[model samples]
Target: MRTGFRSVTAVVPIALAALAYAIVVPVTPARATPLPSRSAPQQRHVREVGDTAITTMDGVYTLAQATRGGNVFAAYCKSCHTPTFHSGPPFRAKWYGRSLVDLFVYVRREMPKNAPGSMSDADYTLAIAYLLRINGMPTGAKPLAADTAELRRIRLDSVPAASSPEGPAR
Candidate 1:
């Protein structure tokens, strides 16, 4: 019994020491590297109002393109969803301030419900143009490009403020 007690006493201290060492040995301070600087041209910033590249001010798409898109919407989209649903207040509320590219990508990938992603990129682009036009966004002289990168830069918030008699324009 004394031998057994001795062994347990000796083992417990050694086991605890091993555990303490195991817990304490692995911790080390971390060093982080600073990020490299970018050139002025490489760092593009979007400004409110004046910056055409970021804001959808003068309209991103052309009226001609929108007209063609209207045709596409009538043929492929009108059956399941109405233009009002796409361009109405509810739709604007959800989509405003987001990138037009997001809308384009969604429509291209998941539109036509029964036959999603079936439409060509051109068709999808036109459809978006039409929706923007109906939603009261301005129409630009140049058509909105089908390129995703360019589309990403343009925000979808070009809706005119609503007027209120009791307070300032909302």
Candidate 2:
């Protein structure tokens, strides 16, 4: 029932906080060292999030951070991108397997229906990996990267033609 904090109790917390800060704040020799900058070109160090892993030709990533990304997607994207509909076709009558790499690139480039490129690499990879999994691709030991070089290698399987459809393409 005491909505207002008594001055005595408030003073104790403030004093304790000040005492803790006083103890933690060092007033001795400043231990500051300048780290040497890399002379060579900067390389993007792949940071693994948590459990989401992607297998790419260049290397592998165990995206431990993808779990967060999955939740982010579900909260923002599940309404528009229904898992059942994200298949080999247009959820109705269209072939989506024409270009596997394009789809991957598009998703990586823009997705989540809210934030594009704002997501961490781990999130991006996990979203794509989950999409691929839904489309029938098997998950490998390693996680995928945002690299386009590896994605172009594997062809995506769209809706197979009802019959022959002129046998491959001309």
Poorest stretch of ten by lDDT in candidate 1:
161-170
* Residue-level error in angstroms, candidate 2, position 119: 1.4
Give the lowest summed-lDDT range of ten residues in model 2.
52-61
lDDT of 1 by residue, 21-85 (tens): 33543322212222223456423433342234454544567778778778778777888887657
Best by lDDT: 1
Colliding residue pairs in candidate 1: none
Taken over the whole model, the C-alpha lDDT of each candidate is: 0.64, 0.42
TM-score for each predicted model, relative to the true structure? 0.63, 0.44
**Considering every candidate listed, which one attains the maximal TM-score?**
1
